[model samples]
Target: MELVINKILNEEDFELYLKTVESFDIINPFYKLLASNIEELLNDKLRYFTLKNDDGEVLVLMPFILRKVPYLEDGQVYYDVISPYGYSGPLFNQDMSRGHLITFWKLVDEWYKANNIISEFVRFSLNHNFQFYSGVLIPTLSNVRGAILDEETQWSNLKQKVRTNYRKGASNELRADIVDGVKPEDVERFYRIYISTMKRVNADTDYFYSLDYFKNIARLSKGKILITFIYKDDTPISTELILISGNTLYSYLGGTLMDFFNLRPNDFLKVEVMKWARKRNFKYYNLGGGRVDFDSLYSYKKSFFPNDEDVIFYTGRKIIDKEVYDKLDKIMNAEVYLEKEEVMEEENDSKISFFPAYRRNAFNR
Candidate 1:
């Protein structure tokens, strides 16, 4: 099939875009939500593009933000292009299978060389149960990235702990208002428990984005974003942010009032949302994979992912114009140009997930 690459200008065109990628999976919500977030949260504007065939088939989708590295500029400007700005390989039509994957990459590779754009990595951060990327090659990387897979078959019968917790939570009486809009104050209520949830687990809760950021996303998504509140006798106990895209309903972010353990608001709210999703004709709900390996959160997500699948991230590096990068490094940081041997030595000494410069600029830049 002959493929044509085109850029999308607005949400009005999104429905047409969906026709090309028919199988709505969990990653679909990631594409929709991230595009919404980047258009709002990013300091720079993001461009959307699609790869379609002569038969009008959209083989792959790429949505990217044009991020310029201030400290790493090469005078020749290019972007840190991540379509979706978060996870998954290029979004492809599930029906296409692996047929067009290599072709899609070839197109992408040629596009990068021609445009002088360098894509160091594409993060597959979506929470889904699908094992192995359906239509893409795992890029060359030294280490195996870790992920938690939720399989319904392995869990349909339920492990003893999963059965117990789910049963316990199932017995609790609860209700949710899964309406189209979200009040800033309602979200603020969620923030309270969200902060506590972070602290309880000692996870970093550095919320860099302003309140205005989320408000804009809710608006841009055209009511596809739903903020549900679980209430107990007029008191709100928990809240969830859910987005519908394609055939999937994604459980984005959730929090519960720390004091209302008796109400079991969180558990109640999830089941309620799952049932609501079922009524809406959504095929799958991505509750999300946990950050910690084999944690309670993983169990909770698995409880809902009946016959679910595991998703992993592959980091890609296409060193387009090495001459440009070399010169840019000399002007930027002393640490940017270390050899593989030195990098291995450094890795052996210690592991650091965040860089000092990037950490400083994460919020402001």
Candidate 2:
């Protein structure tokens, strides 16, 4: 087997990479639609490492974003790698022996070290593809997923509160539309509601995306992007951006107008989207976790699959070069201290807890 690292620079190469991976029955959510858009937003380089056999068939594909550390001296550049946002890690096209997997990981370590990658952080696939990860694994959060069942069974499985909200939305003349392709106006409407919702919740700056990002997603994802909008009378009240990969549907990003919260537009929108996914024979709808464990957002998503087992999200943290990692950590902490005389214990705890602790205050810098 050979390990091929692809850093696609041109559109043709990017398209070819997508085609090659789509040919396999791999469960990957880090497709180009999401990764490429994020790459542009973060100004990071994206690379894919694939293990190919003698027959030239790809056995495993791992995608990551390489971010360079700022203020480094010329020719002494250092980088860190992280899996793209959402549930993504090494995607396997077929199962392999444990020994082979071990060898693959060792080679991966060597490659990262040679490439000056100081640390690695990964959000493993929600499908439990945590094989051969010789890193610190932490249970991050719980993602709520609903298995597509027969219409009768699916409706019966929802929590009574969810059903009541749906009923209320219906009674209040809230209608939902499942749109396969996005238009400029549709993106504008979605962004207005989405940004407003983010502000309502006092979301961090990272959660706020530009309008062009959504436009790029719509343009680049081909037909794999779906937008579900909940409308009251003629005004759009809630909207969700859903992604399709393999047989699963991901509820990627969404928001609702606070004024229409009483109408329960979000609840109605989710049910309609799931119904549409079911009709298309989709197997799962992954409603991602909230900002914090068991928060209001989590409770809302949990109402969909109240009886289903908790689907925990796991993150992998690996320090490739401990010496450089420690040096950087100390430097960042010192910088923080010099800038601020008083530091909250809670903030310090959060910074230390983050993988690549040096980056915890990256935005503040």
Candidate 3:
């Protein structure tokens, strides 16, 4: 087996990567175009890693974002690798023996160390792809997924509250329309409601995505994205941006105007989106996890599939160079002390659970 790294610079290479992804039957929201768009916004580099057999058939594929470490003035560049924002990790084309997986990871480690990689992080897929990695794994939040194979069964399985809210929205004459394709005007409308929702909840700066970012996503991932709007008469009260992959529909980002909360637009919007996905033969509707496990957000998503089992999300963390990682951790700790005018022992302790302990502050910032 040989490991191939595709930078995906030109159209030919990009098409090749897409073909490989399809060959593996691995489909998720974070494909090349979306990842490239996000990396471009963050000024990072995207790399596609694939392990192929002697016949040039792909066995495993994974995409990573190479982010340069901050505050490193040692005249040498160091980088940390992370999976794309959403659910993604190493995807195997087919079940392999233990020996094959061992060999694959060995090659992966060699490549990371050969490059100037300091650390690696991965967010495993929620669809239960066979993942093999020699790293510390943590069971993160649980995402609520509703199976929508049969429309009748899905509606029958909905929680009473969700059913009631959807009915309420219908009674209020709130209508939902799934945009045929992402349009500039629809993106603007979605951004307006999304920003208002973020501000109402006091979301972090990182979550306040730029309008240009949304526009770029629509442009780059044209066919893979779906935009749905909930309208009251002539005004849109709620909107959701969904990502499509294989047979699943992921509720990527969405928001509801607080003033229209009484209309139950969100609940009604979700039901309509599921129906739309079901008609398209999608199997699952992944309502991602909340800010914290079992929080109000999680509870709200759970209302859709009250009896469905929780799909646990797992994250993998690994430190390639321990010595360099320790040095950076100390530097960041001192910087934090200087900024806060006190030793943040508690904060540091809390951050120990976070991987690459050095960049804990960066994430918070």
**On lDDT, who's better, 1 or 3?**
3
Candidate number with greatest lDDT: 2
Clash number by candidate, in order = 8, 0, 0
Q: Distance (Å) between predicted and true CA of 266, model 2? A: 1.1
Off by more than 4 A, model 1: 1-27, 38-43, 52-59, 72-78, 86-88, 95-103, 124-173, 180-209, 222-225, 245-247, 275-283, 292-296, 303-309, 313-317, 322-365
lDDT of each: 0.53, 0.79, 0.79
TM-score of every candidate relative to the true structure: 0.64, 0.88, 0.86
Number of the top TM-score candidate: 2
Write candidate 2's Cα lDDT for 1-365 as tens digits.
Answer: 77888876667667777777676676454565644465543453777888787998877777777788753745688888888777777777565655656666777888888989889998898777777787778788888888888889989999998899999999999998888877878888889999999999999987898888888778777778888899999999999998888788888899989888899888898889878888889988889888778999899899998887778898889999998888877676665664342443346443126677777666622
Deviation from native of the Cα of residue 121 in model 1, angstroms? 2.3
Which pairs clash (backbone N, Cα, C closer than 3 Å) in model 1? 63-83, 88-124, 129-309, 129-310, 130-309, 152-306, 152-307, 152-308
Candidate 1 lDDT: 0.53
For candidate 3, the 10 contiguous residues with the lowest summed lDDT are 343-352
Output the TM-score of candidate 3. Answer: 0.86
Tell me the lDDT of model 1 at 166: 45
Error of 3 at 8 (Å): 4.2
